[model samples]
Target: MRVLLVAYGSRGDVEPMVGFAVQLRALGAEVQMCAPPDFAELLEGVGIPLAPIGQPVRPVVKGVVTGTAPMPAEGLPQRAAALVATTYDAVAAVAEGFDAVVATGLLPAAAGARSVAEKLGILYSFVAYFPTYLPSPHHPPFERPGRPFPPEVTDNRALWELDFETMNVLFGTGLNTHRASIGLPPVDDFRGYVLTGRPWLATDPALSPWPEPADIDVVQTGAWFRPDERPLPADLVAFLEGGPVPVYVGFGSIPVRDSADVARAAIEAVRAHGRRVIVSGGWADLDLIDDQGDCLAVGEVNHHVLFRRVAAVVHHGGAGTTTTAARAGAPQVVVPQMADQPYWAGRVADLGIGAAHDGPTPTFESLVAALETALAPETAARAAALSGMVRTDGATAAAKLLFDAVLTAEPQQ
Candidate 1:
């Protein structure tokens, strides 16, 4: 009953897998998490056995997202490809001694884990938190700015096909190199290169509706939420009670060139509406000046408890944050920066639960308007309504499926 969960990226990407591992353990399975060194302590604290793989690629990935550093000519994708290449050997080495390999859909980690599982003949599965991995007419890939296509265009699947082809064109050289190292043939179809027959869609059906008559063996489980809620800090509790309900602001672990500017903009935008603010300095390294009377800027706090007390949530629209806000029934202001963020932002607006501001870096006035719109009573009601429909036991459902897959794959004793 031992399993290996391979995940990478920042807290948003890693935390959900930890929650998934916890559920597997509750079902009487031994779970070992393969992740970056940044999460070593967090995994250990949760009592999950750690199988550290991959270097700290978070900074490099952040650089790609924020344009903060000088990269090779291929820009961010090349740097990401290089980072994944460096970790492939490490990922393959640690994947041994596990009954099943459940890989999160980070390009680097998933590709490496899939390669090892195939070579070893072990049961393999994948987790796609967002819709990026699926080539469906319902949505385009996350990196694309917006879904400007008409239904005819989207339904034709032209964009989906193009995205797959483009990925291969962009990263195929490095991917082919790794495939050769692993003694596997070069991929003929980029869409199927990193996918397995059984892949778990780790998002709530209510939020990201499952496409009907799916082409792949995809499981539309609800979002993998942490099973337990941490206690709120006394000072935070006092702050929440002291004044008007504050807007919760954070970008999770995504980096920005100048976080101070972003934070200042967030504070001012919310303050324009006479609302207090609680800002999370998540991996953005946001260093704020004094909170003054209307703002409380600090390091991370437990979102499960904090989001419930907030008037509205303003964030970068990561899959993890989007789901957390939905579960807490907090109206959201999504200011997407890069990758799948814009997709989630658009989704919030489509659902009528919140507002989405375009551009990687939104202006102060745009943020102010988005936040104001998000706090509208109708939007709050819509968010609350959706929250009630969101299933929170995604970990348990996913664990059951993985266990079944393991049983199905294992030879007779």
Candidate 2:
């Protein structure tokens, strides 16, 4: 069988799909990817064939983080239309002869790929990394740019109704335009069409559970990730062995303004607790505070190895990072920036594995307080206990499911 995995957005969005692709290949299926060009290097490293789609995401992300881009209301509709066209063109060009197309990432891109799958009469599945993306009475929908739920609305069901309408307003036109061009019908319920009735939820049930008595029949697959096999760098090894384990801080692909100030605050907070610091210079470009041996700034290292050696993980509360830290038995302090991050932060605190900082920009005091809680012996004990419960076979599980679905759909000779 041949599979085309389509994902677009930042590393957080693309990496999980790559993990699933690896598992599919392991099952003797040919796999390819359609994603942003920014991740070409990462895909190449893993040996997955890449059919690059959309623009390089780094500059766009930096612009948004630095407040240099147009507001969502000003440019979103145009950009959404263009992305739909681009994604459809890219996927349609290379999706032929593939048995299935699995899509996860930005809704527009997913919609485009799903449309292609519809035209070809092949299997298409949409997988969400968090439960909030799926409609349920348990939680409200994620706020879209330029669209916020009315203050008077307190019920979850009502909020979801509004969310579906908002999705139509923002993306329905562009999506329908492309669908019509491809001889497909217009999608009235745009969000429902993309998510499908039986969408897959690829999250650890222990970390992010699907609330019961919900609307949809969700297939809750455990979180999908390839186990990191890279050895730690020699210099990082030296840092880990240099002293008591240090607090590990990183924002991954989420950019922040004034990263230097953020770095200084984090260092001060960690030092106040009498611990060393390891800073990851992600897209934020965070650097070490000074010529101090107690602190180290690194780029792109194995979290699987590093998290196990950390005193605590302080990060932007991305789903992938949260799961990594949880799996490594490291306590966490989640400082959420935007879009489902706050949800992950809440899950960390609720699980008793970490502390959830109140907001995105962490002050010296906030970091100190959160770190104090995260560094507690009780928190570490809980984190270690939770590590054993996190499943390591989510990607393999998803791959087998996809394989069976394809085989069952094939016409018998």
Candidate 3:
């Protein structure tokens, strides 16, 4: 079977798919991932074969905060022709000849998958990294602007319910109006557009429910790990072995408003509690002051590989990261910066596997307190128990779902 894995966004989004890809290959399935252009080498370097696509998705979420395009319209269909003109060629390039196409992130890839799969008569499935399948029905809204929602709307469900007028504004008279200049037919929603999975609903497994019927095959596969994880970094391995188990502090792809402040506070907390620190800066840099001698600031460490030896894991609550930490048997302290972070924060705290620093990440005192709980003996024991229980064959589960539910379904065409 040929599996076409389509993903966008940063390393956090693309890396987990690698786990699935590696597992699929072992099962005699040909798996190829098409990610942002910049990830091409990193994927190759890690020995995971990939098909490169479009520009890199830089800190676009940060772009929204930085006042770039009103919000996270960094690369989306907000301006009608914006998506059509840019994504048509991209969709046209990688859309053909796959048993199934799976994607994540915003509308372009999902829409593109639908369009291309329809034309090729293949299956399309979307895998959400977090639960944005629909707007939060039971919580305060993220007032962030330029969300996939159009300018004319207020309530999330209203924007989701695109009326005919909104459709006209969206699609206009032509399928690819701007493409006419380059000579191409206009396009509309592509094909088999299903947001097939919701991994985190406000961090509560129960809340992540989809309003859409189960007909679309939107099932959670839990978190997956690649069969081909790189051996742990020499430095990380030595550090873990050399010291008392440290609390791991790092945000994944998402950034905080103040990295320095976060680092300082984390270092202080570590000293106060008499513990070493392993900071995985991830995309952000965390070079501490000379005074922070014991707090090791760093970047680009894989959680699956790093969490096994760490005592307590503290981080921004990306589903993949949190899940890996849990599976590794490490208690966590979550300082959710935005979106699903808060949700996961609550779940971890409630589950007794970790603690949450609600909203804007609470004060340093809260973080210190949460870390104390995370580092406690009982918390460590619970996390260790959870590690043994997760059945994290995410890759296998997803592959099974695709083969049985999607690829085997009647062709979309």
Candidate 4:
């Protein structure tokens, strides 16, 4: 079968799609990918043929991390429109011969993919990295912006109903406008568009055990991981060996306004408790006072390997990083920025495996308190236990399910 995978967003969003492409190819399906231009090297490194998506994602991601972007409720439609325009041409090409098209459940990609699939009568499936897109009475809505709601909000599904209604008003016009231009009928309800088909939930049930009802055919695959496994640098190995297990701190792809302040907070918090640190200078430019101190500021390193050796992890709660931390049996300290981040933070705190800082901007005192809670013995024990029980064949399972869905949708000879 020929398949086209559409994934547009930050590095955190595209990396998992690369893993699914690799697995599908291994399972004998012809697979190609469409993503933002910045991820070309990453796709090439994994040997997947790439079709470029237009608008660059770096500026938007940087803006959000640095506090320049619009709030989620206010700016999502504009972002969605940009992504849809980039996705239209590539998805149109896929419609000619592809058996299936799957997309990351970001609003723009999902909207564009659905349009193309409907126009061509091909199977389209939604892949969610977290359960935020799927609504349930058991948990809060995915993108609850501003201050969090009351503790009793979980018992009220009307909040979800209201959010969905607001979503339709915010996003429906752009989606339907695009659909009409392409000779497709208007999608009356955007919420209906989102929850219509069998959307694949790409998360471990142990980590996000949402009680999805029998009516919704949600595929609960574990976290999808990348194919490459580069060895740690010799200097990093030496740093690891030189002292006690250091706390791993990195906010992958989320740029900060003052990286030095954040790095200093991390370094001071760890050292105050007599521990060492390994700081990942993600998109931000973080420089420590001295290279020879207990803390070492380095560029990107392999999280799969480094997380295993670390005592705990402190990060911005992107879905990919959160899953990696959980898989490595390391406790997490979540300093959320926007969108689904705060949801993951809530999950961590609920599970008793980590502490979530209350504010988007973390102060020294808050970071210190969160780190102390994350390093507790009970948190470590819970993380380790959960890691042992969570399934690891996410890529394989996702590939098989997509292939099956296509075959089933096709008319038999």
Candidate 1 displacement at residue 332 in angstroms: 0.6
| Model 2 per-residue lDDT at 96 | 91
Q: Give the Cα lDDT of each candidate.
A: 0.77, 0.90, 0.63, 0.78
TM-score of each model, paired residue for residue = 0.91, 0.98, 0.79, 0.91
Evaluate residue 302 in candidate 4 and report its C-alpha lDDT on the 0 to 100 scale.
Answer: 85
lDDT tens per residue, model 3, 21-84: 7777777777777777768866786576666656556655555433453443332245434544
Indicate whether candidate 2 or candidate 4 has the larger lDDT. Answer: 2
- Judged by lDDT against the true structure, how good is candidate 1? 0.77
User: lDDT tens string, model 4, 128-214?
Assistant: 888767766655565444334555655547667767776676677778778778888877667657555567788878887657563
Supply the TM-score for candidate 3. Answer: 0.79
- In TM-score terms, which candidate is top? 2
**Winner on lDDT (1 vs 4):** 4
Model 1 TM-score is 0.91
Please rank every candidate by TM-score, starting with the best.
Answer: 2, 4, 1, 3
Any runs in candidate 2 off by more than 4 Å, and if so which?
410-413
Give the better candidate number (3 or 4) by lDDT: 4
